[model samples]
Target: VIDIFNNFALGICEGQQLDMDFESKTSVSREEYLRMIELKTSVLLKGALQIGAVLGGANEKDIENIGEFGRCLGLAFQLQDDLLDTYGNVDVFGKNIGGDIVAGKKTILTIETISLLGLKAEIFVELLQNKTLSRYTKVNDVIKIYDQVGVKQIAEALIEEYFKRAYDSLMKISVPDERKVVLIEIAQNLMNRQN
Candidate 1:
């Protein structure tokens, strides 16, 4: 059990990678983003809860439920990140900021835009890649691609799924209320912030 638990524990990062795939703005679609998020973030979050319950001596059934709960929670956390990266202020981002969505390469928003824009995307990419182009144009052209493809709505939907998944995970855990209180607070405080 511990071995399975360990493998799953590390597997959690897979979902994060999937989310990264979306954010990278490569060539993803809205549905594709969902699949990645579910696999990467949801699975790992679920695995973590199950691992905890197993170590805590919870029953098998409860472990399974807790795993689901964890998955949902993870989804929520991830979605919140997605939102911040898109709409949050660049000033707060600390480093170079445009909300990850602006880069319009492989991010969830980019995927949506590319799907809609089609071949024009090639020209867009060329302009985006141009060393001579100003950063403002790069951002502008990329956002144009997003607008062409309906990225904003698509990203919004994806964000909602992660939040729902988080709630599902929270509901399934078997731990006492006290044990969960801190976790809930963490979810509330950390899930959507830019820091």
Candidate 2:
């Protein structure tokens, strides 16, 4: 149990620090951000799937294949989480929407768009820090930033990367397509999900 916790801890810490560094306007290259995401989130999901497949009597090849599939889905899942934290309903989610924005946690969309948006980034960053600003104003300011930096488009592209990897992994599994199709459908549905 300790090892399991330890294995997970490293990635979780990396993810948290990555978000903090990104959001606080600290320096982070795009490569550094992706590396952090893959380590913190996707690695755990991949491990779980691999261990389950092995314990269930799957061959090494099959386990490896499923692990890759899980990795792709996990990446997409984390990215969707970032999107939701920005755009989803707070009441239903049971957390403050755009907490990430206020915290300045660097996500893929945020990191990617900052350079593209130029001076507007500075304005939005300031607005995010203005304690007197209303929630409505704060949200609108973020939306404007999103529009300027093309966050929506960037999200779509990142999700597409996950989907493509997932597809290839599904195709690699030696199991019947009928048995594997369910997982593929799950991946597809996750990619399209809004909440």
State how far residue 49 of model 2 sits from its true place (Å): 0.5
How high is the lDDT of residue 30 in model 1?
64
* TM-score on alpha carbons, each prediction: 0.70, 0.80
Runs off by more than 4 Å, candidate 1: 9-26, 31-44, 99-105, 118-120, 127-131, 147-150, 174-179
Worst ten in a row by lDDT for model 1 = 96-105
Per-candidate Cα lDDT values, in order, are: 0.62, 0.74
lDDT score at residue 46, model 2, on the 0-100 scale? 76
lDDT of 1 by residue, 92-159 (tens): 85555443533443555555555666777677556545667566666666666666666767666765
User: How big is the RMSD of model 1?
Assistant: 4.0
Per-residue lDDT of model 2, residues 21-49, tens digit only: 65555446667877778777887877777
